[model samples]
Target: MSTYPHFGTDAIHAGQDPDQWSSKAVVPPIVMSATYKQRIPGQPDLYEYSRSDNPTRGVFERCIAALEGAKHGIAAGSGLGATTLLCQLLKSGDHVIAMDDCYGGTYRFFTAIMSKYGVEFDFIDLTDISLMEKTIKPNTKMIWAESLTNPTLKYTDIEAVVKLSKQNKDCIVVVDNTFMTPYFLRPLELGATIVYHSVTKYLNGHSDVVMGAICTNDDELGSKLKYFANACGIVPSPFDCFLANRGMKTLHVRMREHQKNATAVAQFLETSPFVEKVIYPGLPSHPQHELMKKQAKGFSGMVTFYIKGNLQKFFDAVKVFTLAESLGGFESLVEHPWSMTHASIPKEKREAIGVLDTLIRVSVGLEETEDLVADLEQALKASQ
Candidate 1:
């Protein structure tokens, strides 16, 4: 048995043991069989079917669970798939309260797909404790939120939200810890009922795998999610699972560098004349900087800022930072959220929540901070 005593140690050794393999390989081998052989009548091996269980997928799930300090973990085909499976916990007419500034994909899922099934959702600014308290209906079954909201980098008070959920015993406080990850923040330790992640981002760190995961200390809830994942056939492939597990081994190291680069980038952007506003939880200028300090161990590589000139010129001038949609990788990426990641959201509604056209979101990578800052400086000058 492997001991997960610390974050860095657990990230590498959890859910993995060299002695378990017949070949005695140092790393877990990818088990790609669709079905396992039965040893007796009506009895099969550890995994009866790939959809329900696979050795590679199990290792990945267990590793994530251990990292989050949870008893169970469920992996999905995509981040949105995990979100969709989570909605299975709700039935007809069940109410869900989510943050207004959540990821656009989540908003679309809640409003478009889930609403068609007779589920109700209310998008509220979770920062306002009183407003969140007033919005909870008698039928509310879930409180969905992101620890650090996408693009905007707004912080959610997990403790406060958990307290509110306690008022209604049945209400499950589900947190999308995609931005912070287990390296920086473990929502399960903060009293959240569930924590989910887009493994395509930080957990994978290479942007090669598009997967999602759910971790929870609640055994029953974990079982339900696992069942839904099997029933819905939304589970990730064995190969993806293997890749995610490998990626997690270096998560602790990558996160520290990401945080260091992001802090420097945020500071640089804050002083740039071409930059209008910089929003990073690590910076004192952020509205929830102190709140993040209390809730998380460290900030992530994501940084959002507004530019002074034409957005297109700035987007076109960047040489080092790729103009991309996704985040949390080894190479830096920048995107115009209004037209990229958040485009699914109606312009009026998106703007109302502060995702403006001039808002540029940066996913600071492992590059030297000086080079990144110089690239941004030259890009700004060229745009001008």
Candidate 2:
């Protein structure tokens, strides 16, 4: 059997051995050189070029790989960079089935850029096993999904999707395990072909860095992904990797507090007369609450709801929470999906996916529970 330290120990110590550094530094030092000197003309050092690999980035990659319970981890320039690399695995005639209510950026990439290459995509609800069964074709090379979808917080049973993928052996299952994080859910453990993340979000736990990662146990797939990153020059800078490494060390602690604060906020919203509907996997009212409990450890800090009153007034009235774009930060954020995050999605499709104008997507931070509730309480009143 394989042996490894606990999650916290690995997060702090993986790929961080001081012996690897000439200076014997406790923390992994950033190697900013564009190219490493080689002993001979043809022979190269372990990391010949920064595009292929960097010291700091390696540390973060190893740390994330350990956390995700995977054999390989590849870091990219941004969340979309990781996504773009994954799509590179496809060809002109390949078909892909993706979650209908996925992030706006992901939807835009599939419909606009990937489709232009003659790769066909079908956006459908992955939660319904029969829908996935009916929509899947023999040419479907990839089944992309998110456990808790963006803006709406709908749940997809990732394991069930993986089971279905088994029927089509050539197809790969990719889960965007961003909202759940490794702390809450490791999709690879559930038999997913690959688990990916927009490292700018929960993996970093701070909004400072924009990076992306993909972890997999498949050796051949790992090699292909790494080649894509190097050939396309879609690698993250050493400094950004350094910042993300620092941010990730505190992930376990931050996630706990995030869950605490978010659970309280969701409960409050469910009781509010101003809120029309609340979507949080942790709550019993959520459609997939029991399944979520079966598939993962805990729900992180995301809550989505529909307002019964003035949306603009509520967004403007928030005192503690900031009106912002990105999530998984130390500070609370409230975003309107229809006008803000999901604006790139066509209006008709947005409506079809249940992303209404009154829908509110909040990234509940590690703020005190009472204070966050009080802020929302007033916002609801003003929205009326």
Candidate 3:
């Protein structure tokens, strides 16, 4: 019997046995063929069609499952694609309770697309445990939440949510673990039914590939998702799978740097005269800082703040931080949530959730802490 290794070792070695391949190469080879040769008329060896499965994608899937401490993993073309697969589990009239301050794309999908299909969704502030309990209905099928919400950095209590799921036997808890990744947080161990990620973010660590993944420990749920994945043909290409797997190998190191840099950036912003508020789970001032400590190993690279001066001037003055969309990349980026990420949400709804026009969300990268601090310092002064 083979012994299981540590998280870092599992990342680089799990699902990639050099001896399994004829080439004996250390890296998992990208199997790009659409179909594999069958041994018999209808008897396919391991993989028959690429849509159903690919060797490269299998390795990527297995590696992520191991990282997330899940028995199964399914890859999708994009993050929303993974969520779409989860929604497929619900039939007409199924109700979903989702965090009010969630990713804009997710909000759009739930309200615009899912509603048309007869799936009812309620957007609520999940931090209020009583509110969550009150919102549950007999038809409630899923609770969609983010560990640390985007732009605002609100922390969700995964254990509490899981407890609620246990009380409601019909409900399955699905957590979007993209921000924390498996390095900082593992939702399955905390009793979440499913954990998904946008591989375009930290899991890829580079902004190149767009993909998503679903991880679960339930055999039946995993099988159903796998069936839909193959039937619907939403799986990613072999090359994108290879890239994501390669990026994940260095996730441990990259996440550590991200945490360190973000800590420095958050502290700097808190003291800035041009900054009205700083939001980061790592900071003591954050409302859910204690909950974050209880749930995650470390806080991720995302930070958000409200500017006291002109937001445009601050955006224009920043030299190092690029103004862009998306988070969890190696290069530092800053974005206006009200305009960039949360634009899909209505202005009133956005403001109600504290996503104001003056809000700036920063993805602190692997840059030197002093340099990043200096850059922000200069930018704040210039804006004033």
Candidate 4:
């Protein structure tokens, strides 16, 4: 029997007896078989096929659920697939109350795509706890929010939203815990019924494996989601699941270094003359600094700011910070949401929602803080 360890230790050692495999290897072996043999005709099913379950995937699922304090975890081929499975819970004519400042892809999924399919959704300001109560509707089946929102770097009050959900048992509190990850903020512990993540961003820290996971503490909800995931046939390949699981092993150490570098970078940018406003919870100036301290273990690796000049100049003059999409990896990445990630949203709506052209979002890497700072310093100077 395998003994369980604390969350940090579990990342490295859990769910398996390495000595049972050849050479007594330390890491969990990837069981790539698509089907498992069942001895008896009327016996319980043992992985009838890979589409329903795989040993490698099961190991990763259990590990993630244990780490996040959830009863079940389901892995999907992509982040969108994970969210899509949850969307299956919403029937036609169901109402969804979502954060106004969400990942552009998510906004597009609910507003543009799902609407055509008959699901209705309304955008609400999740930062305001008081307004959230008013936004709830009788038909509202879910309230969606990001722990640390995309591009905006805004912190949603998970505890307050959970309180509101508790008041209304029918409303399922869904949190996108991608930014804070389970390592920092355990949404299930905070009363979130369903937690989702773009495993592409952080959980698969290497950025090599594009995957996502949906977790819940409810057994029935977990079974339903697992059914949807399998029925839809969107499970990740054995190889991808293996890589993602391997990445989880280092998540604890990687997130710490990422937060450390991000904090240093945010501090440097705040003092830079070219910077007008820095939006990082780690900084004292952030509106939700106190709230973040209460909820998150660390402010996380994402940093966004408004550059006080022409957007073109800032965009064109970066030396080291590669202008790219996606985030939460060892390499620092930067992008302009108004053009890149949020292009799906109309120009007027995007600006109104705070996706400004001059707003630069940075995913601080695991590089030396001094080096990252120097790169930014040069970029800002050159932008002028």
Candidate 5:
């Protein structure tokens, strides 16, 4: 057996305790100092500056790395920062293969912005191995995907993609393991060279922090990425790191309840007269249910479905579900990506990827499943 107890134990105990500073305090103290002093005239400081490093941020990095089974982890100001740093690993004229269905922000960043700098990219259905194989070019540098795709909940066969990257020359496999979190899946162990998380979501659990992380087992790449991260100077603040670290402790328990509530909600949607379709990897009807079982320890907390008839009614009828942009919090939220979170994408492109107006994405929370079901039941009926 592994020396550590499973995820639950690691989440609470992986980082250091500041008992030395204050013996009675159970939680790690927020190291708010902007600089750590040099112990002796010529000796190294514990931390020279807040921007480059902080003791609190160090704890966050080590805790996340321990959870992800990575040798190094770096925290960034936001998920976009993490993505931008990863893009630095490639140069002009290099090609990247990305899943057709990913976060709209990611698609926009790579397709619109990165293309200006001469990086080539193609969007293909990652579930189709042959399609991915056909798209690879001589200078392909990376294969990228979100394990459980945003909005649609489509999944990629991570191992298959890793196998392909291994066959290719000088290509690295990267996964945005945000949806499932490290508690449910560790993509690095599944052959991905790197795993990333937008800790703004479930990892922060309470919706208070907005942070991102990049983790890898390769020390050389980690060093290069860290250098660029420091160079960019978009690291998250010390307080945000402290909040995220506190949230991680309850992640294991929170995820389990989130899963249970989500499954209940999905099942209710499956048979509802007002629901046309329900999208969750846990459901047998999902296209990648089998693949999800093979790759993830449990189905995630997000569920997307199409409400019957006009989407406006569904959006208007909900009383408890907040109309919101983000997910993976303790409170449920619903959003229509076509007009809300993903409005930045062109209308033609949004429809092409199945983000129809009727679509509703829910971030199920720890609320009583019955209350949630009843809320949906009433909302759907009232809307009609």
Candidate 6:
């Protein structure tokens, strides 16, 4: 139930309807005409090009498919072009499973570019539901899910992987909500069949747009995901869809100031001494913090940890964090996921999924929680 049932008025008036235009302008007019002016000359009406349609990318894909309650919304050109337009809904001998701490470019686009197009993937640990009931076979078809994973935030439960991929009623779960962002989860109201997004982190919370999106309620899989985003042109730039719809009109107050400066810098790095572990599902020393409060309504601003000092001396002593390698932005950024974003996963599959080497990953932004906990408490006392 979207199109404005709340989440800050569906992020400032879902699809900003200023009387549909002609300058009634309340804030939706970036329509950079890449082509659109046909009136019965071989019948073309509701838009006809700009890589297949654009009115400022249909008002940020109908305000991010009405902030994920969704009925359709598709944008791309990044977030691995919405995972290559959802791997064109798979086929070449299809089979997938994903989510072994996903997001290192979606595990190198499912093992190096969709395994050269014959599909086939596996990557386990989807909260180990008995190793996904011993890997559902018979041409699997898709499962993916990511929830709060990436750089070791680990969460995967998307309603128990949509109740075990409906025992393959032609399986399809696909959730990567891109670090919990329908402003804190809405994996298609928890039975997900589609809920992608990188939307350049935190729904464009200002890392200056990189875009990518998807959402669905399944009208023929939203008409084959808008015909694979206009047949793989990978749409997205109408000025980065008007700067990601003006950063989703302050996505619920920038996700409550990025979860209040990441729960005050992960409770000062779990009472530092240059901490050793502190994953953060809004902490209860998170071990799925009660299944992240029984399926998220909060806890984002990802906070991964493990650092008993010196990771390049806390990335050369942070001055209000920013060692960088992408993340939801307003500023604070940090990295070193076993040498930046799971260094193409092979150091024994990034330490068999924990991504060690002093793993850090922060992303928490919208700063000023005591200046990001006095710059991570003087960069963990200059990394001890």
Per-residue lDDT of candidate 6, residues 66-181 (tens digit): 88888898888888888888888887988898887787778887787889988898888888888998997878988887888887887877888888788888889988887778
> Candidate 5, which segments miss by more than 4 Å at Cα?
19-25, 39-43
| True lDDT of residue 275, candidate 2 | 89
For model 4, the superposed segments whose C-alpha errors exceed 4 Å read 1-4, 19-25, 38-45, 310-313
* C-alpha RMSD for every candidate: 1.7, 1.4, 1.7, 2.5, 1.7, 16.4
Q: Score residue 361 of candidate 4 by CA lDDT.
A: 93
Error of 1 at 243 (Å): 0.6
Q: In candidate 4, how many Å is residue 244 off?
A: 0.9
* Clashing pairs counted in every model: 0, 0, 0, 0, 0, 0
Model 1 weakest 10-residue run by lDDT: 1-10
Look at candidate 2 and give me any clashing residue pairs: none
TM-score of each: 0.98, 0.98, 0.98, 0.95, 0.96, 0.36
Q: On residues 1-384, what C-alpha lDDT tens digit does candidate 2 reach at each position?
A: 656576777777877889989999997887899998899886886878999888989999998999999999999999999999999999999999999999999999999999999999999999899999999998999999996899788888988999898877799999999998998998999999999999999888779999999999999999999999999999999999998888888888899999999999999999999888999989999989999999899988999999999888998999999999989988999998899889999999999999999899999998889999999999999999
- Candidate 4 per-residue lDDT, tens place, 1-384, comes to 664566778777665457656767666667778777887865636667789888778878887887788889999999888878999898888889888889989998888778987888988789988887887777888999999888887888888888887666577999999999988999888888989989888888887888999989989999999999899988998888888888888899999999999999999988999998898888988889998888878888999998877667666776667889999888898899988999998888888878898889999988788888998887788787
How close to the true structure is residue 28 of candidate 3, measured as C-alpha lDDT? 92
Pairs of residues at least 3 apart in sequence or in different chains that clash in candidate 1 = none
For candidate 1, give the lDDT of residue 48. Answer: 91
Instruction: Report how far residue 296 has shifted in candidate 1, in Å.
Output: 0.9
Model 6 lDDT at residue 297: 86
Better of 1 and 6 by TM-score: 1
lDDT of 6: 0.84
Encode model 5's per-residue lDDT on 168-234: one tens digit a residue: 7789988999999998899998989999889999998998888899999999999988888888887
* Residue range 267-337, candidate 3, lDDT tens digits: 99998988999999999999999888888899999999998887788889988899999888899999998
Residue range 1-384, candidate 1, lDDT tens digits: 765388888888988988878898779999999988888967875779999999999999999999999999999999999998999999998999999999999999999899999999999999898999899988999999898998899899999999988888799999999999999999998999999999999999998999999999998998899999999999999999999999999999999999999999999989999988999999988889899888899999899998898877887888889998899999999998898889999999899999998899999999988999999998988777
| Residue 150 accuracy (lDDT) in model 3 | 82
